[model samples]
Target: MYVRHVAAAAAAFLGWALVLSGGPATTATAAASGESTTAAAATGRDPVRLVGAPVLYAHRGASAYAPENTLAAVDLAEDLGIDWVENDVQRTKDGELVVIHDDTLARTTDVETRYPDRKPWRVADFTAAEIAGLDAGSWFTPQFAGARVPTLRQYLDRVRFNQQKLLLEIKKPELYPGIEQDTLRVLEEAGWLGEQQVENRLVVQSFSVDCVRTVHSLRPDLITAFLGTPAAEDLALYAEFTDRINPWHTTITAEWVAAVHALRGVHGEPLEVDTWIVDDPAVARKVQAMGVDGIITNAPDVVREAVGGF
Candidate 1:
């Protein structure tokens, strides 16, 4: 199923690329930019490499244990001793960057009863203050009755306080204009970039090439990742912008990982290959053996244990 999705999405994007470029071989120079991997890529001087091969990343905190994206989830992930925790960031109506997975508040929040007038309950429709008032936890279970959505500052503080690294995703960035700059601004003000710890603890990633490029251009020193499978040319271009190319785990192939690893990145470093959302320990072991550099999942404990047993 995952391989099918990857193939379908790749084909669709290829078609879109051809349409935009008026020709497949002509429009995407990035796809056709190179013949082999750079020496920099082989050096492996990336944040992802520092943690070692098969690094474990907590997805939306320990989402399997607590409400996803809530402070409770982050706390649990940190407690589990995961190498890094990942979270999604979106802009509120008032321009504050808050943490949440979905563009709408209905599934995670009691927005239907809390604000019936605000039909559709989109995240961008409400101010940070308003979003704070919504119950972000109760929906998951009765144990967490009033978990509120955390602002980017609040989320980073927790990660920093715990001395854990982060894999921050700019969710649906196209929905919020200038969000790329705003995110970089927030991180800068929060001191995440202090002493240039980007290679040590921070990775800014997004599904949107534009957002990834935006962040890379703003902070050339920081590490970035692309969360999609771009064509060969686009993959080469991604190599020029990000330190990693994270793909869905279901369809990942050893050759695919090797292909990306063979490319050089913007800082002349190796672009690591990481896969996401794998929960099964057996499946985790398979991907690791396949040479995936990192594994992003909700069950960090499960994967960590699997890694230890090896």
Candidate 2:
């Protein structure tokens, strides 16, 4: 996993370099007033009319710049005026909901140094308090030496305080049975679901189809997305519950996107399509041209600037 992270980070840097060599994107929001007043106004001339702007979700809370799933990363996304930030949730050994990505704590935390004997340091092996004690940011940079793991409550508070929306991902939820219910219970306690406008501000997504079904069955009022590639039959089945079908970039195409657009959704909206981890300017523009409504990116600023929109 650490090897994968290094490879991804290196690729991201190279993509940025290629983007830098180019002059500037013609449809960038800076020229919003040149012809069409806003990104929405410009969409009519294109293949798809999105909700408002090109929706950009700061993948893993602007993970490209700051440590992923930390307050520092989320705050940086907010500071950049990004409307949406994404995060992952997993349970600790004591069944407490904490925000982190991997099933283990090797790449982003000091778990190996702190507990050398614990091979394959699974998150569920330690209590939340014990998990919280590890330094989460120093691995990224010394400037962020003391960042700690945040509880789900703290993560929700940060998102709410920023006045931003969240793409809440239930990570590896199958490992902890009934985590879907536990997640909703935590959100209910946080005033994030079941009673107010907060529900509208969240889009619950999961790679696990079972987890997606759990969220859909439990609270259909809240938006839900199915992440990863799904079979054609699976897509049709999920269309009943999921508001969006967010596949990987590799699986998406113009025809697939158009087909999804034609499908009627039970939620009274178009079968919204979104895709992830796009960073290069050329790729971002291609995604937009493919009729994708949203772009989930680690490089939020570049996507919003080069791809042009929110």
Candidate 3:
């Protein structure tokens, strides 16, 4: 069934591509552009060679050094020589997309004190401007005072300007309706989508299978990763739609990795397997030996060193 759907989608894409190609010269140019984009997207920027070990992705932009989901955290990851940074995305009440991990602002901002009457004061209930008004950084450190929650465009621009790869987690799709559409819109508006070649540099991840499916439907070229706890049945389901499977590192084993690799997607491609929050050097080495494609961690510097030793 998955293979059939992929064939159908590919046929549709080919039809669209042909319709856009009116002349031979135009057709040739489009084909060339498509090839270039595919190559660029396939090559991720991480420095750790994946031949012997998994790539190191900075979880929440090196959350140990800076507030998670902040631009500062992402910048810190880049400066630390990490190749790829991971962050989360949530929608606002006004349909603006912002970078944040939690559904509510209580933990990261001073919202509870300022707006006492706002019940269920979730991030989805506030507009972008309302979210920006709250101090999002001081909770982590006094030095990071006045840090504001950034929009998806701002975060993408920063990542692109720095020439970095990203693992963008789409959070809480159920609470925020039309999140997939909003996310695609932000990527398109930032010139990250469309016929451009940078699609491979970005990986759209979600715990929700439906949301991941929605993204895959709209942009088949963009890599989609399904995040879930390690379970044979869950992994089997994810094998249908995702290019990669990210399971909690604690639950991952060699058998799990083998199972994920054996399961093919709708494209008949083997799904890449990765695990997260692997901060210990010994554990990192162990997981790398398990044959996972990447390891997401809060401590990229430590993982980089461990990978270098191998």
TM-score winner between 1 and 2, please give it: 2
Tally clashing residue pairs in candidate 2: 0
Identify the runs in model 3 with alpha carbons over 4 angstroms from their true place.
1-50, 194-199, 233-236
Q: Count the backbone clashes (under 3 Å) in each candidate.
A: 6, 0, 0
After superposition, the stretches of candidate 2 with alpha carbons farther than 4 Å from their true spots are 1-52, 194-199, 232-234
**Residue-level lDDT for 28 in candidate 1:** 12
On the 0 to 100 scale, the lDDT of residue 3 in model 2 is 7
TM-score, per-candidate, Cα-based: 0.81, 0.82, 0.80
TM accuracy, model 3: 0.80
Clashing pairs in 1: 30-233, 31-232, 31-233, 31-234, 32-233, 41-270
Computed on alpha carbons, the lDDT of every model, listed in order, comes to 0.75, 0.75, 0.72
Candidate 2 lDDT over 182-214, as tens digits, reads 999999898888445444578889998889888
- Candidate number achieving the greatest TM-score relative to the actual structure: 2
